[model samples]
Target: MRTSRFAVTVTAVLALSALLSPFGTGSAQAAASTVSPTGTNNWSCKANAAHPNPVVMVHGTYGDMTVWNTMGPALVNAGYCVYALNYGSQATASMVTSAGELKTFVDKVLASTGATKVSIVGHSQGGTMPRYYLKNLGGAAKVNDMISISAANHGTTNTGVTAKMVGYPTCVACSQLMSGSSFLASLNATDETPGTVSYTNIVTSYDKVVTPYTSGYLSGPSTTNIKLQDDCPADTASHTQMPSDPAVIRLVGNALATNGPAQATYKAKCTW
Candidate 1:
């Protein structure tokens, strides 16, 4: 029964990836020149002294800073300083490299915010890319917490099919890029979840990508994985809706406000 369920999940993930393949092409670009305000006025008005770290948002594959269009402002309004950057572009001259470019951006955020460390919130590849920064680039000390939304921590197997179809090496290369390579292995070898940072993996059972949603989990003492359905029960949010899901937004609000793992109380109404 477990095997059958896993297979169904994998099939659903691949199908969702195919469905989103169209709008999912682009490097992180500034979504807009002007910053608009979200009416919540919950997180932007003042920075809670307890959680002094600013929040930095990272977008996943084919996504840019714009992915947080709605949530960023909400954070800002809730009294938290918010910033977003685009990394891991494919082009050579693009100024950033996937997984490799995170340190530079982290440095920029630290320097600009005047905060020694910051919390990271990432979506899809955005969530997975930071392992490199944490392990290789000395980011562990600088990052206070990491919140991953629909991130692919372990490499995806759907790439297996693509590998067979488009030459094994090409697919293998892509998987490594999406997750990590020997670099991640070395990091995991020392500490699967480094004690220095708090790791929270926010995933939905209905996620249509990141095959084997269990891949979103991090193995460490400080790491906690929350399945959205378990939290909201009624919320069957898919991958695309994760970033903007109101329940997710509220969960994030509660998480940031409390600075610890808190139960999600918001229930989804089957509106998706």
Candidate 2:
């Protein structure tokens, strides 16, 4: 039963991997600003009183900063300074190494924007990896909010089945994301949500990649776990589509609109 389940999980990851582009690819080239999404990587942007903290967007495996094209502009228009980085060779590298990269990128964002703390918005692995930075690398002191959309917070059971998938061999982070991996064991050791940062994990019932999407949820003080269907029953956004999904974006906006996590009872404005 366990082997069969693993096989199913691997199949799901392979199938969805093809759909995650514009989200990113294996290369780390800086996306062209002309073709790139709005409201990202703008170094000149400064955080204002209305939105005191600049937002740092982290992309998932096989993804880049371009993943935030939709949500990025929304936040920007809402008066936020948004930034993103291409890390882990499009986030396929070891998550530990990627966390270091995140730390360095965040430092640059802080210095440039002169903001004391930054809020983070991530998708898939993008969502889960920041916890490492926060817990192991001292990111808790610098982050105010963490809103993860379909993140593999507890590691997904999907990719550990095999490496026969096209790019699976190169995805060092994949093994780390397997259920019960040492990385996750240590990551979730004592506190899944640590420090003063508010955590909001947004999951989709239809997500196949995370294999039982509840794995994305974090438990601790100031943490909220939301299901897309809970707020909008008709919405069926999948794992990869989350970064671009309208309802998910609304949830993200709601989370950022407050000082802490998104209110559990807030109703999202559903759209097709």
Candidate 3:
């Protein structure tokens, strides 16, 4: 049963990828912008009093604050106070253990923004890692909304290749760590979307890194998990591009709109 389910999930992800292939890819130049700090090393701006909560952008593994350079300015121009950070540094490994570091960053954001809570937008691991802070580090009460872009909430099997090359134990350990293990299960038990905070998961069918993209889903009444092609019929953005895709951005903007529906539709060609 487990193997069949895993296969079906993988097939779904591949189908989504094929659906997104024609959208074209994103460029670093296209998404690049100059980032200025509001105060000290903290990147901040005055929150529109009407929208009191600041928005913090968290990048995935092997990424820095620059990932959101373009997106941040767009949010700021739209009247949101935006911030970004680099976390989960490992001397031996690349990008891992990011969730464990989120609590510290959340505290820093709170201190810099002077807001009781903030909205978080993360890509890849950045998306699901905050759930750790939300559930374990008192983040549930401090976060107003969480927007995860192609986050690996359930874990990926592609890690098996690295495990084979590096050693069985290393790859197995990494996959187990990302996937919902006992620790993650414990966190989920707290409440899928706890407190007054709203949760939004935005995923692309074409994500190659986070295999079996359904792993990105969050099951909760207050949580929304959206597949991008559903919102824009012509959108075919891959995993890496989802963060910068114009269609995805529009969906995110609409999701952030106060008057928008808690539930929205996303359509895509599917194969199993």
Candidate 4:
């Protein structure tokens, strides 16, 4: 059973990597040369009254800052200062250490933009890892909004595969994402939503990586959990594709525009 699960896990990881390679690497490299498609790592951007908080984009497992090539440009066009960073060696490092790295990057963003607080937009592991920064590393005070795309906020059911794989030294972060892992337990022990930060989780029904997609939902005040199908029934975006999904970006923008979480009444457009 263990070997079978490991094989499945490896296949899934490989498939996802292949699926993302074209967009994650090819388009990222091309976008790196252009200014309109990608606007990340702009240190000179300043916050304006219309969009007081600068936006920070975070990527998921096996991902780099380039993962935001689509969403980063969208936010920048919407009149927000956007920034992204590569952390945890493509997010395979210890989550605790990644959270600390996040804190450092956010501090730099705040200082560079002269903004008191910023909004966070993250995908997959990127979404859940920032909670550690908020809860433990004094990030809550520095953040106003957190928009998560397909995050495993409560962990995933693939523990059978990742649990055994963590025996190796290379993937310590993988085990922490398994359901009921020590790291998740500690993260959700007291308050799933800490500080004054508003939490918005935008999840898709077709996410194979984070099985039982509802696991992305958080239980706390100022938290809004949204299922893509609830608003856009025809949407069938997978876990890895959620970041680039147009409907997901719309919802993320809506959440950032509001004072609290996304409005329960907001309906998403069914766009591929």
Candidate 5:
């Protein structure tokens, strides 16, 4: 079932999200200002009343917040107070450890901005691990929205092999991403997307990390599943390229327009 596709400009997307935001103060200053990538925040920046929910960018396994360099500034330029953190950076770090890190960082964002909640933008393991925090570590109440790019949600296979046989003793996170892993099983045991937290999964058919791409799909109320090539058949964005892929960026922007940009899905055409 195909629906109408509208290519709303990024500015319009942010504007719409702001309007539907629970924190917009209708101030001209916050709605239009931009944050430099090197700007000193120290969490001192106040949440834009128009878009009060600060956005926290989480990185994937063996990756850090620097990965968001391409996407973070874009959000800041769009008038959002952006933040990013590195979790599960260690090979031995359990998913619970990363989830705890997320909780702590989220609390800091809330307190720093004096805001009650935040929106999460995670990539790869960045996307997969947060759900554990939300599902088991009491994170649903703090997150307003979650946008996962290439998440290992339902678990994936290791080069067509199951986790049970993939050198599990070395990389804990790797084992967890495989299908049938106890970590993944318990993570999906309850409602995948709980509360009013809107969930969006931006996956790529060219994904090699999250094999069988379908494993990344998240289902729940207000949850949307977007295949980078579904609408743009020409798109060849790989799992590693999603953060910088123009098409993926736009899709994420539309998803962030949670309040009232009825035109969230856009027409995309990318080649090579």
Candidate 6:
């Protein structure tokens, strides 16, 4: 699981890597790579038959919809009707709230697009928190595929301390992120991937956030966990950068391109 940190933690690696990242440098380059589509952000945009499900971008803690500034446009350019949703204030609210809000937003998306199901691509809390909707809130009936980037699937203590020592949960969702919170225990009581939904989780080895990032791995049928470095050994992106990483984006783009057979896993050609 990736760190669900709301505040940006500037590490020396993150700073230096940003200067050399192949994904692009600053906001100017980011804008250039994420080309806008004539149909982007239009709720009425036609959904391509190849990518039938409308894609929804979910942001992490303390993050708003703008977090998808880079990826959102990319999905749009790929002929997907993409929408980004912001949940929780500073993202401190409970997963219950997150689930409800997502359901409402998905309902709106389906109504607007006349599609039955939508695909999801989430980061950090946005990645892990949605399980509640799928497992308990009837989202399994709504979502087709879920792709998580640096998500905290099994829970994480990114603060470098146990949840108990941190004086318990800082908020409702925070409790679930604790290593042994009741919320987590209940969440894992059954299959991690439950339903007809296909899932892919992406993680980076250099993440200082989601301690022991392997905690992000998902187990069950139709679920795949991707280690970004495995595909590109030279990749140096930090946890916060996963959503915008080129390698990560390539995998997402391929997965959504399900021509005749949907490939659950796709490897990127190492370019770093």
Best by TM-score: 2
Q: What is the lDDT of residue 8 in candidate 5?
A: 29
Candidate 2 worst ten-residue window by lDDT: 10-19
Candidate 5, 1-272: lDDT as tens digits: 01112222232333222211110111211121233233223477787667778888876654555556556655665667788765554322578888898899899989999888888888877788989888878888888888898888987775332222222334467667778889988888768787777888889998877777888897776788888888778778777677756577666666665662213356543421
lDDT of 2 by residue, 77-98 (tens): 6668888787887677899999
List candidate 4 stretches off by more than 4 Å. 1-37, 159-169
lDDT of 2: 0.79
Q: Give stretches of model 2 more than 4 Å off.
A: 1-35, 160-168
Task: Mark the regions of model 3 whose C-alpha exceeds 4 Å error after superposition.
Answer: 1-44, 90-97, 160-173, 176-180, 259-272
lDDT of 1 by residue, 1-272 (tens): 32233233233333222112111222232332222223221233333475588887776664556567666665664557777765544111111245456687677667765678888888776777777677766788998888888877775544431232211122222445334455345645767666478787888887656667777888887776778887578787777678766666655655555445423343322222
* lDDT value, candidate 4, whole model: 0.77
User: How does each model score on lDDT?
Assistant: 0.59, 0.79, 0.58, 0.77, 0.67, 0.67
Per-residue lDDT tens digits for candidate 4, residues 127-157, read 9999999999999999999889988888888
lDDT of 6: 0.67
Clashing pairs in 2: none
How do these models rank on TM-score, best leading? Answer: 2, 4, 6, 5, 1, 3
User: For each candidate, what TM-score against the reference?
Assistant: 0.72, 0.86, 0.71, 0.84, 0.79, 0.79
Q: Which stretches of candidate 6 lie over 4 Å from their true place?
A: 1-40, 160-170, 259-265, 270-272
Error of 6 at 154 (Å): 0.7
For candidate 6, the 10 contiguous residues with the lowest summed lDDT are 1-10
Counted clashes in each candidate structure: 12, 0, 4, 0, 4, 2
Pick the winner on TM-score between candidates 2 and 6: 2
Model 2 residue 147 distance off true place after TM-score fit, in angstroms:
0.7
